[model samples]
Target: MIFFRSLLVAMLVILSAYTAVVVGNHGMNLLTVFFADMAAIEWPGQFNLDFMFMLALSALWVLWRQGISLSGIGLALCAFFGGALFLSCYLLVLSVQTNGDVRKMLLGRHMPAHS
Candidate 1:
């Protein structure tokens, strides 16, 4: 069980990292397309906050069920590096779309100007 859980966490980290890269490189349109496909299968409505919430919940379940401590091997690396990488890219897109200043605050010197 522990091994399985660790494997699951690793897979999630990889998938999230891949998604972050794709979203950063190709843009949210690609994510929207992926979400659309997901919706077609399980969700009938347009992809929105609800779908995102569900995904987050599902991730939480995996994290919890794995029984790995927050300081454990998988969680530490994923939360520190992989999760940060994924969230940074996602927030960047959100900042671009909404012109939100919070992104600048979070990214500090790393953000590109709106020019």
Candidate 2:
């Protein structure tokens, strides 16, 4: 479990770094290209719609897991705007905090093991 989580952390870190460099080279107008694709008549538009759904879902899940308070809103915004960057970092830290107990790390609640 720890090994897999460590692998994911490494992968996300590399991907994030690469993406940052690419974005830096391209500039913020890259996001305009990103947004422009949403109007396409094929897979790109579909993918963007799917991503938007998942984006909203992630924000809602963040709110659900955290709460309806200030911190909850803050986390939801992070989950909304940060996307996988926030999720990967959040999960890595959460897994560490929960000692790699996947259920507690993911579900935010503990369950009794059946005998």
Candidate 3:
């Protein structure tokens, strides 16, 4: 699990670079194009919506992970803006953190002990 940690980090770097390039080129019009496509009736449009919903869920998961703390809120915002990049990096960190404890990584720190 930890072996792919660097891969995840690579993905994060790629995503960040992609975002910088896109936003640098398109600016806020990127958002306008995004929403315009959101309203389209096509498979790609639907796929984009589905992907965005997953991103929202990712942000929610970050919020859940952080709880109501300030840092948690900050991370949730990061997840919102960062999408798969943030999520992949988070899981990578978690995988390294818990050793072999998959449950802890996926289910959060408060995962109940098996009785």
Tens-place lDDT digits, model 2, residues 1-115 = 7687887788788879988898899866755675678866578877877887898899888787776889989989998887888888888888888788777765663344551
Query: Each candidate's TM vs. the true structure?
Result: 0.29, 0.81, 0.75
Inter-residue clash pairs, candidate 2? none
lDDT of 1 by residue, 2-94 (tens): 453355556657887787898799887855675677667655444544655655654453344334565333543443334444444444444
Question: Measured by TM-score, how close is model 1 to the native structure?
Answer: 0.29
Which residue ranges in model 2 land beyond 4 Å of their true spot? 109-115
Off by over 4 Å in 1: 31-115
| lDDT of prediction 1 | 0.52
Arrange candidates, best lDDT first: 2, 3, 1
Better model by lDDT: candidate 1 vs candidate 3: 3
For model 3, residues 31-110, the per-residue Cα lDDT tens digits are 56766777886776787788888888888887886677888889888888777877887888788788747778767745
